[model samples]
Target: MKDINLTKEEKADAIEAIKSYFFNEKDEEITDLSASLLLDFILKQIGPLIYNQALKDTHYFMTGQLEDLFSLEKHVQRK
Candidate 1:
């Protein structure tokens, strides 16, 4: 899988969220750099798995919809 690139604003927001989680849940204070690094690691290692699962879910949903559509087809009676 290709690298996932986040926009500047998104990256900033994610970094802030990471910092917040560490502070709120772990009661630990971490710098922006630390949070950024952790975010990078997560995106690099875990992002592909999540992305693939989402694609599979979408494919399954579309396939079901197509089957439902096919069920509505009308058959012509032959003489």
Candidate 2:
């Protein structure tokens, strides 16, 4: 699988979030480098699961829209 890539800003944001989580939840101070490494690890290990869930949500949404459209078309044609 291709590596999960984030924009520079996104990476920075993620790294900061990781740092905050460590500080607040874990009660440990994490450096930017540590947060970055952790971010990469999480992305590599967990990103696919999140991506798949998003795709499933999108597919279900589109299917529902299509079904509604077809139902509306049939209803209009019967008039």
Best by lDDT: 1
- CA shift at 58, candidate 1, in angstroms? 0.7
Count of clashing residue pairs in every prediction: 0, 0
Q: What is candidate 1's lDDT per residue for 1-79, written digit by digit as tens?
A: 7899999999999999999999999999999999999999999999999999999999999999999998999998999
Candidate 2 residue-wise lDDT at 20? 93
TM-score to native of every candidate shown: 0.95, 0.84
Off by over 4 Å in 1: none
All candidates: CA RMSD (Å): 0.8, 2.7
CA deviation > 4 Å runs, candidate 2: 74-79
Among these predictions, the greatest TM-score belongs to 1
Model 1 scores a TM of 0.95
| Candidate 2 lDDT, 1-79, residue by residue in tens | 5788899999999999999999999999989999998898899889998988999999999999998887666434553
As a TM-score, model 2 comes out at 0.84
